[model samples]
Target: MGVKNRIFKYYFPQKAVDLKQKRRGNCNGIVLMYHEVLEDSIDIPAWTIVKRSNFEWQMKYLRNNFDVVTMDEATKRVCGLSEGQRPFAVVTFDDGYKGNFNNVLPVMNKLSLPFVVYVATKAVSDSSIYWYDKIIGLLDKRDDLFISIEGDDIPIRKSHSNSKRWSLMQKALSKLKSMSASERDIEVKKILDENDARSFSSRIGMLSASDLGAMSKHQLVTIGNHTHGHELLDQISGLEIYNTINKANCLIESWTGIKPKHFAYPNGNYSENVLDALSAFGFSTLVTTKPGIWDGSRSLMEIPRLGIGRFETKSQFKARLAGFL
Candidate 1:
């Protein structure tokens, strides 16, 4: 919920939230978006990752309480192809982290949970550290750091340790969104080049091509497209949107022998233009970062997803699923 909903729910219309929850029938479903599933700590914001144990507990909670479904099942429910007789939920991971194979797949297998992992093809095929992870990886290795954003040189003196650097950079990284895709890439390259930064290994980076094939063969796992380079479609040109989608689609098909019909916009950054482009590419559905229950009221291409992050206890997860988010 946004500020408007919060104010209305608390100060004015106290029953508004309850009424909204009450109206959520069997047709409505919640899509949970996750980024990295790591067993160890990462030098990034905790909100971007969930530890292995926490994710397991979350799976147990969902299995016990909700009708966890696959993306195919979800599409049917949302598109009215299947009888939506009960509240449903879908678990999805944005980036194809190696943990999806090493850590996550085991847990999902143990729980028999159906989930989706949207893979950015380049990361897997080329074994590249995602741009965002590259930035964090480079910064995490240095205690004294200077970043050149635009013409400004911002220096960090106190951000020496891993936690401190992560906390400091979390806020600083958002500013890069203002720059053009080329501009941001150029600046990131400059910083890393001067610092002699090496890209993080795919062993701890993205899912490999083998992982893609493995997940594709799993009965409960569906591989989806993230993009070729994890490009923010709105920040780049329409040509980029066209090219990235096609390239990703092709690569995913080559690896998995099946083209993905669903996609997740990079960083959840998308507009109607992006949606139209995705639709033109024949993508059946796409998800956004916006938090809410999807009840077929919005465009299927712009489905809202609830983001689940680090250290989210079972109770907190239950409440969000219960529509108290």
Candidate 2:
């Protein structure tokens, strides 16, 4: 622990941390959303990939400190049915990353933790790269990146600080988010061509259908459809949105032989139309990127989740679960 952290813990005891038990039987639950879980690597962006060791530590923390519940149980508790004899939390992974099988599964199995993995079927079936990963690949090819985003030349300085790298990556993501689907693809392609990024295929670090099949068969795992192409509902037409959801759900059902009853909005992007589509499709439980403690109002559908990303410190993780952040 850092000296500052030590001093803070010494002086300001997290009295509320102990109150978790008091809040258990009647309190709201939380759903944690994770993405890729991989070993120490610098080539990938930190936002999408949680280091394997850090993930293990976090799981250990959850195992020792929190009541790690499943989505079904969490939904019931959120709907005013009491918590399952302890303060409840549900673990979920977004996107179908291969490292999930390689790194996260073993840890979760060892810990005997139940979790839900949300898959955007296209990423798995087509063996295609998610756009965000492409961006990271483009950035990794060079230390000093000078990109032209919407006519502005944004110079990503060569810095040793991860914060600086993250800032630049966030800027790139923002620029990409502003573009239409076609435009985004064009821009990513341009970057790839310019960088001569040959090895940046979608299959580099993502799960295959067989991997998903194996995971689905795990007693502690549940598959949630995250839509094909991982499209943002708010950005696409209603028809496109419906087709995406239908296509993804159908593919997942075909793969797992069980229709998915749960869904998570890609990138937490949604709208009234998006909610309607989810409703039309009959997702028994829906989750979003919104950060909050789940209660009666968030059950079955439109549930909010907390993103346990690399930026979060140990204390911040606890604080977030405890509703202190």
Best by lDDT: 2
List the lowest-lDDT window of 10 residues for candidate 1.
5-14
| Structure candidate 2, residue pairs in collision | 128-202, 129-202
Per-candidate Cα lDDT values, in order, are 0.76, 0.77
For all predicted structures, in order, the TM-scores are 0.83, 0.90
For model 2 the local lDDT of residue 309 reads: 73
CA displacement after TM-score superposition, residue 267 of candidate 1 (Å): 1.2
**Clashes (N, CA, C under 3 Å) per candidate:** 0, 2
Candidate number of the best TM-score: 2
